[model samples]
Target: MTQTGTASKTVFGVPVPVALFFIAMMLPTAVSVNLGGLRLSAYRVVLLVMILPMLLDLVSGRRGRAHVFDFLVLAHCGWALLALINWGGVAQGIESGGIYIVEFAGAYLLGRLYIRSYEDFAAMARAYVGLVLTTLVFTVPEALTAIHILHDGISGAVGGPMAPYIEPRMGIERTFGPFDHPILYGVFSASSFSLAYFVIAKRQLMNFSGMAKVVGVVLATFMSASGGPYLVLMMQGFVCAWQRVLGDVQGRWAALFSLFALAYIAIDLFSTKSPFHVFVNNFTFSRESAYNRILIFEFGSAEVARYPLFGIGLGDWVRPVWMSDSMDNFWLVTAVRYGLPALFLLLALLIGLVWTVGQRKNLPPEWRRARHAWAFTLFGITVAAATVHLWNALFVLFLFLIGAGAWLLDAKPDPKKGRMTQASFKLPFRPAARLF
Candidate 1:
């Protein structure tokens, strides 16, 4: 029995498979080895491997309540296949689409299956913290030497360069360590800042250890040296400040968001320069570097209009010759690649997750706190997605959170019993079918 009262088999309070999953997720590249022509990433491989338990449960006839988001995820995958087909070749489509199916579908299903309780959510959060800490082992050295240790080995293992150490930006080489990019490392580090603080806020971690972990995450974000992550950090700080200063944040958050959206629209309509150009020019000192992103939106709008239904195809957008095919914005990118319906589904999924957080009055105290924090975190990610493509490790990490949120939303504590029974697979049926 664990904190959530589910019968958990664990080596040291943490379930063995869950622990292995976290290790695989956290050390995807570090544990990776090249086999002939294939570079086997531990993270990707482990995510697939983790499917075994769920399959076994399915074979054993475990079923739970299905949420709207579940269908949306599957639908998203279907759209992905269609988009890949739009790309041109059936073989290439399967090859490209298969990985995505693994990540979006596989990760989501894994989360829904395993992370069925708050205790599981908490364990995963701790594992995320562990993962972040582990990266510093390599990131610190890379930062000091201006060299990435994982670069040569990972590339050689993959049979090609996977994460080439790039030239320094602003005279400082960003340290990504084992991650694919510095921006990804930075965004991931900044993303975890809120989760780390959540543990402290809940009084889960204490004294020197907790403070040190928080400080380490802060430093990691700084070492990333990317503007996007810096913005995410600032957004998180603002969210925290909003919660502190205001007695309740919902009303004020909505008002502020509305005002900002309106202001952005107003600027885009009235100003000679579009809002994207204006924002890039004013918000970032490296205006030249951000020009491509601004162009993505500027050109992406036309692309969105062109393929309002099913998109032109995955990775097959007609961009200005000067502009690369990169659609940096998640909403725009999804709209362009998978079509508007897919984009709408993505938005529905995100909004639904946040909305689920506050929909109930009977939420456990712990879940109540999670509701507020996750709402802000989701908002921050949405903002960050505008600047970077969302198909990175950060998205994978976020999928787990979404699964947790779904669990919280669907679960209701028993009033008479005074606690919820842990949903488990019994011989013939799932015990938590009603709760689901």
Candidate 2:
């Protein structure tokens, strides 16, 4: 008898997963490993802990193919096999593959395990939003410092061999703002920022209050100087246009949302105080680096042409053919490293997800709206992935959760003696869902 509402069990009645999730979600402090003469980040080191639960399950009790988690596991296996085969060129094939697995895949799975119910989902949403906010909080100071350090507006940040591959063209600093990198931070901001828009837009549709936070975060993302985020976010607007084409939900707000998105883009394009300029200064100002991404993209296409079957390999990004001395633009990276197959898998997963979510005909109206935004947000994120890898962990994790969560709720609703059982999965922590 599965308990309804809150107070329901998570993962065989253990509360540790949620706690573990919090720790894992915290912005990691520096740490690394010492392999003889080599050292790796402590953050990377802890990533391994995330794999234990899944690994144990795989070994202890095998599950049938009907399981939702199975696909995620399959993707990782494919990634591993690709890594092994391509070896990313033994010359510089070295990357924190283990850490990449744990940190990137681990975080997503943690979200899934902990976000088992509706309240949990809300909590998860808040937690994810919180991270975005956290990044923004730190970014204010970081950007200020970065500005002073690099002296923004004076000239573009100087580009060196270690600078962004595309910086030579754009001249923008692409400042990190307390994140690992400015471009990475911007990508994170854009992904979460898009999610925030989803929330605010839904609120408008529902006549709910809380548009303030989304406004603030969107502003913060603009300051990150990462061109990819700007480009991806713009794509979200295009997606909303497509959604309107699908006729999922028709109303003034839908059109208004589209209009608002366009207005934002227009303003950014003309704004002279380019956030990109502040960060990259020089990288984006030049035509050479501006066009370099195309060259790199071509590089990937050539590699794919030579090896169209399987990719160079998944784990070997730093290898000569794929990611060697290049920046991450989602489509090219996937095509180069794993060949065409990996990129195809990505498209298939995204399309399949969009279809499943769009088919949720039984959820409560509010839940339906929430899921709609989820799908649209994903659409934007996928487009953004073409230019940024933030989708790798932070954004992609949420997408997987939505897909699995929707699948979990597809069964017929429980008809209580009273009102119809909530047509959604209630979280373990929501006040209404709470057991206490």
Candidate 3:
């Protein structure tokens, strides 16, 4: 349903639905219940609770025109389930596959339905900034003390530890916050970098509060001490700088793409290792970690080649005895677990959304800025996911962000003038008191 007035329902300056999603994500995984054989965590429970309303909105056309990415998401879920059923029996397959459907499709539909306007998106960005600030209170201390306060407290209240202790790196502990892993925590924090700077800053890049938001995000990211999150921060920072400096230049993005292509070709032609191998080696934290990822890619791709259709499912993959069973790469893991089609559909949804949203014309300056922010955020995530595996909250949040951008596609221009509309980018809440 459309908002009644100029503003939407909000709590503490954040949209109600957006705040709910953030709260669900921040909840400790320990706060969960087992249903039959399935374990449903806090975020999963939230998704389950919202599924009916989301479906009804979709059926009634209240969410507006559906995009190809929506269908791709559904197809990805459907094919994944079919493949799982083919590998395992129907009962086992449904049991395993249903979890993914709830996590991916459910979170995605929430974003697609509730966040249907500029006000909602801006509120989401503001809520994200607030989340980064709040989490920093836990992440900084956790990084120094090697004790995750929020996670430990929740686990203690629930009678057990939720996550295993990760050893310190570079004479300091890697911060886990309330997430499953330090990298996930870092990636989640890093996702807001572009949003905070581009969307929150609006027309001025050096706005004081906007810079504070950026610093908060950077601090939270550094607490993770993981290469994946560091890469995201660096990439997003570079893109932001590029836009600020050369935004008026024609074909700037095309030039950047061409330069990357040239570099990839040069590395492939001259280097002994493949471009992908070199990329993995250079972007990792330690020599051992780099070598391990290289071996994983080498072996994981082989497994995908062996089982190109339905994948091996729960069966053990053929890897060296010394190699770890964990697959660090999310894209490779998807291909290895559910076949190439699953990966293809996911890639299509991601690439198609970014491309289509960027290509939209006649958007106001505010909408255009938000589009760029969302695009670069996804761009960094796409590269980072190739390096680290994402699961649970991180995965659901990724899908939700994608769905939240669907409103850009259906945005209408000034029909009478047939040109860009000039709309003031003002939030409904008091800027000075609420934003900072």
Clashes of each: 1, 41, 0
- Number of clashes in model 1? 1
Tens-digit lDDT track of model 3 for 59-79: 665555454567788899998
Report RMSD (Å) for each prediction in the order shown. 5.1, 10.0, 6.8
lDDT of 3: 0.80
Where does model 2 exceed 4 Å of error?
Answer: 1-29, 34-47, 55-69, 72-76, 86-105, 145-174, 205-209, 237-286, 314-324, 390-436
Q: On a 0 to 1 TM-score scale, where does candidate 3 land against the true structure?
A: 0.91
Instruction: Please provide, for model 2 over 1-436, each residue's C-alpha lDDT reduced to its tens digit, 9 standing for 90 to 100.
Output: 2232433344322234544444333332222346753443333343356468644543332211123333544474466445544655543333434444565455544444434443444444555556667656655664554442221221132221122322311333345543345655665566555455554445453433445556656656776766666655666656655555665555544675688677667657877743333223333434554455555555666777876766666543333554346545667766766567656765665565455545555555545545655665666566556555553234334434444344333333344411123335332222111111
**What TM-score, over all chains together, does every model reach?**
0.82, 0.65, 0.91
lDDT of 2 at 386: 54
Residue 3 error for model 3, in Å?
5.4
| TM-score head-to-head 2 vs 3, winner | 3
lDDT (C-alpha) at residue 128 in model 3: 83
Q: Model 2 TM-score?
A: 0.65
